[model samples]
Target: MPAGGLDIRTFDAVKALAFIGDLSMGQPTDHSLRTAWLAAQIAGAASFRADICDTVREASLLRWSGCTANAAEFTNTFGDDVEGRAAMLAERPDWAELLNAQGGPAQAIAPLAQIHCEVSGEVARILGLGSETEATLRHIFETWDGNGMPNQLNGKAVPAAVFVVALAGDLEIFSRVYGLEHALVLIAHRANFRYPATLTIPVNTHAAQWLDTLAQLAPAALDAALLTPQMQHSTSPDLIADVLDLKLPWMTGYSRAVATTAAACCARLVADPEASERVYRAGLIHGIGRAAVPNAIWDTPTRLSAAQWEKVRLVPYWTSRAGKQMGTLDQATELASYAYERLDGSGYFRAVGGPALGLEARILAASAAWVALRSKRPWRDALSDVAASELLRTEAEQGRFDSDVVEALLEGEPTATQSASPRNIRYAAETTRLSSREIDVLNLISHGASNKEAARALNLSPSTVRTHVERVFRKLECTTRAAATLKASAMGLLR
Candidate 1:
């Protein structure tokens, strides 16, 4: 049984989030999944205990959790070259070579590596992982010869699972990119220097068979295979959200804050326990999709162009997709995807309206907006609570937000000072240049409503609705509903 009576589903959810880590590292979508599978197999072949196998698998999947915070540093030093960075990492360069190649001083590399390891370990702790797993993650890059970047533990001093994972990760990558024989060669070359001889010997002996097993493995099958009954103690959804929130400096603690505030609001509204929990979960991961966008875009201190804004709008869609990968989180994920939507059908990724938007989604949106207003952005300072409330009230009054949701958010807050009005706040004005009717038609189409259904809803003839949609496409400089929706969302035309 899981310690603390936590559900096994929590582990399943964490495994799913590993895919996001893979993306952040610029690897294939299933890189983490494959790494975990390979690591577990290597552990089993080496006769590791069942618990050790489980820890290895978990550690391998989450080894890159620290990359979210370190990506900007990598980009700044390496200039967005994924393959180059991969090559540099594969060579296992010393601190001097790494800094020299990246055009940074040798002194800067140690602190960066240390920060990455510490952050990864912290995330593991927050997720309730065992200390062994956390230690393995922290020492993931440490080598057998005591020449690793963060720590220089030699031979047996390195954590067993970390050694196993380091070899397994490279095995999967080389085997996939090169071939089975080449992967074995690479392992042999690095043996006794980067990986333990005991682990690498078994891998060398059964290279072909191991590669065969991994070749047949699929990303979707990973969770069922790795998350065995004994593999308990999964991280809660809220903690998973926090892991994603760490990706941006501005977004730190944003997800947890939203989840807590939203859950409290749900309780105040007298929602049932289930409803409150669902909203809380949704709030926790509402920004999970933000990972798909680059940190450069997120950290930019200027207005986003139309294309960049479209990328921002699709974050919620990506979050929903990530959530859907876990069987138990489907509902919460769906609500999270709607976090950027509005009551008046002004959301991006999907232009949903009042009828289609659920109460949980409304509360999630309200809470996210409230938290964001209070948090500092690259372009602006954090808003005072009263100022945020006033801005949210203005949004509600304009029909972009639900009045009830806004009221619930502001019930206990002090009134805004006179200086906090819209006239004083620097708002990103709507620039999509779409008329109200065009926006209406776009919203209907976004919800997958047929032209006839849209006509019925808007009380117009099918011909009129079609004309309006066509004009929306033309005006937005797009040819399809999907493109138009994205563009409009990026333009901030949607609520």
Candidate 2:
């Protein structure tokens, strides 16, 4: 784990999803994380199984994960989705009035329907969630009285996680926006209506305690327990998936899938175990940078304007940043970021030729593209496997993908392995050297620590922590914490 906080992976996937949720609705940030913690406590108090508690926490984070993927539609009907959501929260309205405010119902139905299904599906698939969990997310908006979106699943049809998350989410929001007493009252009022009556009281009670204990708990206390020993023991494949997903919802489980696919492909090419593990880890974090990007750009349904596209292109940079913060991922970060580059100078950030690109990078690029194409998107339906293959082939012929890597990817061939081939593993010559304090700050940042949290951990003022963060970015040739972390990992400073 990095200094400022844990590596993005150690926390529950739900926390990351909740971050996206908070961003989607423009809520006071950290609402999702707080809510998730509350939900976990509620689950424990209610005597839910340990697996159920974990599931509840994960669901709480994912409940709103899909909300951002449909931002364009929400913005179109509501005129700025973020602002509209904020208004709705400030003044709770009747369902009828809320629908009417959503552009007189007619214009809103399609977008709303699209939002419900698309978001539900995206969140579930991205997390590699089980069908039960997916069903839970799909029915998150259902009412006990049989009025909700799509198919109205009433009461028991909803999963326990849904009930727990819903109750906790509402409780946290109300408590933060209003007061603890008011939050309790609100929870009581919504019981059996928006909430499952049986779970509401327990959830609300636990939430109240959480709010009271807020000051006493360590910044990392709740999150620290969510991770498994494997994550800390060694950066396992599942650990990588967890880390990437927790950092960026859009990239939930993305690295894991890529790692699995790439390692399988590479294994056929060679039998060196260490090389295989390295290749796998490389695949696991290829999209960590996607976390630094706002959900608005990531979930937009329409074609990105030129400005938005630039933001899209920054995901790799952020991935590299997180790697640098971890101390031993600098080379991995570079390969991850360059996964988007074309062989013919048509790629982003850098346009280095295919020959110059690493074999790991070429496979990562092809695998990422393949997975993305086959996976559904807000604007377009997912492509068939054949269609995705053809697209990769087209890019390869265009001089974007490496010829051998493309063939391997298309034919299901293995990653070519030469016995521990020499590779560049240092920070770019242009990268600035950060001080030890700056590196510490960067590590805390990659773990999602707030300035206050970082300050407390390091015995520094919030203002001082912020200053150190700024210095880290300047010296590392990066801007965000995610980027700085990746730069450090590239330099082996984060380890």
Compute the lDDT for candidate 1: 0.70
For candidate 1, lDDT tens digit of each residue in 22-41?
66766776677778888888
Question: Residue 290 in candidate 2 has what lDDT?
Answer: 56
Q: Indicate which candidate wins on lDDT.
A: 1
| Cα lDDT, model 1, residue 74 | 60
Candidate 1 weakest lDDT stretch, 10 residues:
417-426
Each model's lDDT? 0.70, 0.59
Quote the RMSD, in angstroms, for model 2: 19.6
Per-residue lDDT of model 2, residues 1-495, tens digit only:
101211234233344345445655667546666777788878888889876776766666666665544444565566546656665664566534766866654466544644454445434543455565666776676666655555566666767677777788887788777888887888888887777688776655566567777546664665564442322332122333443344333343345557656665555555655555555666666665554455566667899999879876876665555443343454555566776767776776666665777666666677677766765566788788788878888888888877677667667632221111111123335334666787677756654568998899999999999999887766654444443433343343432
Clashing pairs in 1: 11-234, 346-495
Give RMSD to native, each candidate.
17.9, 19.6
